[model samples]
Target: MYIKRSIFSDSFIRLLAVFLGGAIGSLARAAIVIPLAINPLISVFLCNITGSVLYIFAARICGKNLKLVKDFAATGFCGGLTTFSTVCKDGAVSIQDGEFLLSFAIFALNLLFCVASIHIIDSLADKFGKASK
Candidate 1:
């Protein structure tokens, strides 16, 4: 006897959620980064900051109830939107170009801002949760 399983399995659905979210996130990143007539590093910084904020909001709102939303928004979307590799590459290139200070600033500012945004969003979510309760 042969048993057939449906194509739309649980894993497949999750994969699809991530894929769709990633595509949307990537497009959103491009939309923000492409039009800016500024330094590439600055554009990338904006993307990372925005992604961090969105990731926090998604995590807070989705929590444990919305597994797919968390996976899609936080994991897939934010992962696609933020570019750690780009930051590293840019910093490396700056160092190679004898712009040591610029390289240092790039790494420092991104780390500071992203972490701060996460913390701020988490705090706000906590307050909002308490108030709504």
Candidate 2:
């Protein structure tokens, strides 16, 4: 029987994707964070947004059949690699630190750039897909 991915009803394979994805992403987040005492929230902003875009890009580029790559890299690696929780925390901190303007700008930047990046990738994939056929 085939099992579709859902928050609850996902089978072992899908669950594996979620679990491994979260783990790897989390580790990568730490790796990006540990090197500097600089504002990590900005770093998180960049990471999550970029990761989100790539997630969409991967989905588009791989089409539907690239399950293994999506599961391991996009879902696991990217999920863990991005840190929404940290983003929120940093946003709050930035606001409290009298950088509300900067914080708001960062939020907008992430949302805008992430959406654009995904579509850009999708467009590239579409072009390549047609050319190959």
Which predicted model would earn the best lDDT?
1
lDDT of each: 0.92, 0.76
Q: What would the TM-score be for candidate 1 when compared with the true structure?
A: 0.89
Per-residue lDDT tens digits for candidate 2, residues 1-133, read: 2334453454676777778888878877777778867777667776887688878876775667888678877878877887667667767888899998987877787778877887787788778989999
Window of ten residues with lowest summed lDDT in model 2: 1-10
lDDT of 1 by residue, 1-133 (tens): 1223454576788999999889998999898888989888999999999999999989888989999999899999998999899999999999999999999999999999999999988988888889999
The runs of at least 3 residues in candidate 2 whose Cα sits more than 4 Å from the true structure, single-residue gaps closed, are 1-10
Query: Would you give me the overall lDDT of model 1?
Result: 0.92
- Looking at model 1, residue 30 earns an lDDT score of 92
